[model samples]
Target: MRVLLRAVKQIYRQPLCNAASRKRSIASSSEGSGLLQPRHEKLIFCSTAELFQELGGNVEVRTEFISEEEESAFMKELEQGLRKKRYEFDHWDDAIHGYRETERDRWGAMCTGVLERLRTVAFPKGSTLLGPVHVLDLDKAGYIKPHIDSVKFCGSTIAGLSLLSDSIMRLVKEDDAAQWLDLLLPRRSLYILRDQARYEFTHEILRDEDSVFDGERVPRQRRISVICRNLPS
Candidate 1:
């Protein structure tokens, strides 16, 4: 058996608390839906003050960062066609959509709303600048192969908010596959990758595997990921 690292052991050592579960209600597909609205589902996070993990060297996890209402509302907007039509990128296996600040028409305003939420409430301490928000839609079989974000285009820190389902993120060295780590990312959680993680390691998710977390076998579910890069310095 692979020896579990300190970060992995520390995370499992903490008592697992039930996260508030509130499933988002999918609105009927409308060709022309306005801004995304909040549906207000109850959400919960671990009872601990904060959950942190050092897996893959330089990544930190904040399990259940956004509240139930916040997550539900965000999804409502996304599924209601507020975002640009979903498109496929040859480089990515999953259908991806995003809103950028530069495009000042529709997506720009929508993306700015996301940024405002992160500033006023999400961080709680103070506001942090984030780049364009990209939404990753994964089907039951959807998974991302190992890869790294380009520091040339984005800041060193990358944060992603998980919605809808639980999944595993496997981190591996680009040149050495033997060195790897597994992270259990629960729904509504926010994980940030930076420093070595942003610059050195490549991250991947297995195609719908039973992700093991704290000795429990958690099955993979269809998930949505909203990724935002750090504001450029």
Candidate 2:
């Protein structure tokens, strides 16, 4: 019982609403329905960057991590490298549409150099880079559904370099759907997710019409993300 109470207190520290203290994972009634009651999923869009930091610095972003010149060169290589690969709309679980993904253990000289720089900010000294690096292309109308990175595929840290266009990435707490955050990923920005932010949050790319930040509609277009992960734990 003491252990359970401690767990409840920890959740309480993370704000929900005015009645946050009264919130319980499973609603109960005097009549004792016994069956778990359904709780409405209330998406609270966190417009500020501070909320992300509240997660013990598990999520971070470095804007303009790469310059325009580097971005252009990387984009050119990505397009050229995957020119022949087919973009598949029908994912096995329908998680992504109008997307093409490929992995490469090695990149061209320019890309290799830029990624080396990315490592300094994204990982600790001597952290192993899981290969081949993942390159995903999303069409102008494409979007990725909410899902967690499989522990089987990668370890805790996953860093993505955004290119081509800007978009919103939403992260929802797996245990509490009402708790969520929307991140504006501009072109040339690098976003990193690790530990709790990487495992506990289900990340998704918002559809174009649904992309909004701080009450302003943020337009999304054909975008690509160069994803790098560490070896599985």
Candidate 3:
């Protein structure tokens, strides 16, 4: 049981004090040869506040999206429900491993509040939301291969609340992989992908060994993302 709480406990302990200290001005992907030029300078930490502007307003993040109590509660519910589950492989994409997922028609009041807030900020007033929320649990060693969500399943805007661990998500142009940007997704942050970000780019969680940010190594740990999508147009 204690092991289950190990990752969630990081929420109350480690503050993101280093976020500003490691901040850097990244030129637009078009300015330089690539967003991550030189390969050695692959990790760049952009401020979440300016991520919308930095990433052409297609991608946005809201840090501190959930309170500590809410996170703790979510951890408890998920750990118990998913502990006995085994990792499943997708026949379409082999890059994903060590992961389990489930869909929920509805969540508790506590989650409802979070979802409300997400829609309030990430979507326009009275936007239609998909009823089934997707919960994906990825092990510390797990990694998601770069792929775009099929338009048949969901709509344009995709909102995800990241929990448990800090991670780096890379969004690369599907046609040109060299043109890419890295997003530092700290625990409890809400990331919203819409329009170009959702359609033109393939999103993937980097492997543990590749989790670097601004010349520093950022460790990847167990993470669970509560994902919500808008109705298909």
Candidate 4:
């Protein structure tokens, strides 16, 4: 009778332990979910034409960009494949060459989508999609110097897709000495530059092994950027 009484007491105590464990598990899961979410505040989504209109309205500050979960996944896959293939740096070779040499055959698809969208917004009368995409690989301390991408040099909008890692692109107006805009281009994000934003402002990637902002220095990772612009005929 004493043994049976002890067993009953133990069984009654088990529920309290299990409830406490469950509460702790729930708290841990919630914390993890919050961290996975993107923390950037200015991330916005807009249709291509809407973005063009906004750009025209605000010449001093104009940027058309978007981030999609599906696109990001595709880009990650592409990055992994490129890493496996060990793509070389060829300054003379165009974007198509890099795409062909890479393991994943995705560069064409990505460029096509951006070109079609840009044409719809920038050239309503229809225009040919010219190519030889520029595939640029930037290492820990590599960066592109600031300069305007004039239509005289390249006749279409500049569409850049981030394949691996994240970086910042700075836009500075020629006239504004103190004003400049910084954009964090995360992995798989797409940035389209055109009009005055392309012709008047200078865009560049800073050379740093890491980036520090708000007192946090984020380490640099290997980055591959696919740049698409129409060739002037």
Candidate 5:
């Protein structure tokens, strides 16, 4: 009986040991991926204070969204298990958004660092885990019209981790003509659009095969964005 118990313990330990080993491997591999390196000649690091000071509104940016190795592994897991799985839509009277429950154990474990980082940022009080992280998939022609987020129950911050593809997020002022500011959000990017950017402007992702900027056409790719925000009260 003692031998059998020892054997069971060994089996359990094997998985834990393997998980640790895999994490080490992932960390090492991420050091080599270009994801950690800045993409452009000028790197943009936006903090809440800087956003308010410069834009006269709240917005922040973190260049490294997730390690490429981690993203590749997660994508593999998603493609194997979560791909083509349709999730329910959270619907209001007129607006609609897709929702999916992330693999909580994995997501929580992986995103702990991200959440910790956010805690240091300026966020509203009474914030709680909004829901399971959701993968918001937008097709070639799919678009979300301008609207403010629902912050009645939770804090006003909405964090998105871009995945799978590249896209643009446009913020339009609420003035007579509704002027716009266009931001190009790349894959594996973290975007925090809140405060005035959230309430005073309408944000949208246009439906198009390509986006044109300065006479250059940027091709669109299928996009999956992971969103984390507080639940509505």
Candidate 6:
């Protein structure tokens, strides 16, 4: 009960509206109904086509996608759930602690506007958004193995949001021995993978203290990622 009250308090913190408190997975009746929601200040991102060109086709990343206040609310939701339910599956090889499939409507209900915005930016219009969306909770020591996403079950494009901390995602060609690109996935960044990048290259999180980006080693932080996908057409 106290946790929920705390969440309610955070939910009303101003300057950033529509910031739903993610506390112990308890949402207000209005949030549950997706009605009469507060308006959120829209975040504007300047697009540069050449950057995507340099990165590759079907890959887009928007940094600073959410503000600090919103981040706090979202974190409160995840952290409380993590504490109480502790519903996490461990993966030793990948250096991952918790991996689980979650329902989009249940988990996504807290911030409907943000999820809608993600769909508009990440998916083609009129495409059926498929679930079970995944939530990845990682501690400081956590990392993931390099592997290509399966197209058999989950087809085409994959979109995800990085929360809590910065991430360094590495990629390598499946059939090649040479090292590939290392990307700095900043906290609050939204990353999308499709086409060549999805089918061709494999990505992972390494078990290193810091990773290089443009010759500089950048440290990683504990993070929670919300991943959503578009079904194969």
| Most TM-score-accurate candidate | 2
lDDT of 1: 0.50
Model 3: per-residue Cα lDDT over 46-139, one tens digit each:
3242432445667765556676778887777677778888876652346466788777765678877877777887876677887777888888
Q: Mind sharing the TM-score for model 2?
A: 0.77
lDDT of each: 0.50, 0.67, 0.66, 0.45, 0.48, 0.54
lDDT of 4 by residue, 20-101 (tens): 3322222111111222223332322112223323444222211223236445644554555556554433323121122213
Decreasing TM-score order of the candidates = 2, 3, 6, 5, 1, 4
Segments of candidate 6 deviating more than 4 angstroms: 1-55, 85-104, 107-110, 208-210
Task: Report the C-alpha lDDT of model 1 over 97-166, residue by residue, as the tens digit.
Answer: 1211111113444445655654443332433445346666666656665556555566666677778877
| lDDT winner between candidates 2 and 6 | 2
Ranking by lDDT: 2, 3, 6, 1, 5, 4
How much is the lDDT of residue 226 in candidate 2? Answer: 90
Off by over 4 Å in 4: 1-38, 43-125, 209-218, 231-233
Better of 2 and 5 by lDDT: 2
Residues 1-233, model 6: lDDT tens digits: 00000000011011111223112112122112222112111111112223224444455656666666666766765676565545344543333444432333554444566677778878878887676557676666666656665565566777888887766675554554242444556677677777766766676654446454434455766677887777778
lDDT of 2 at 181: 65
The runs of at least 3 residues in candidate 1 whose Cα sits more than 4 Å from the true structure, single-residue gaps closed, are 1-57, 82-131, 210-216
Error of 6 at 214 (Å): 2.3
Pairs of residues at least 3 apart in sequence or in different chains that clash in candidate 3:
43-214
Per residue, candidate 5 scores C-alpha lDDT tens digits across 2-69 of 00000000000111223333222221111222443322212222212222244443555454557776
Model with the higher TM-score, candidate 1 or 6: 6
lDDT of 5 at 61: 48
TM-score of each: 0.59, 0.77, 0.75, 0.53, 0.62, 0.68
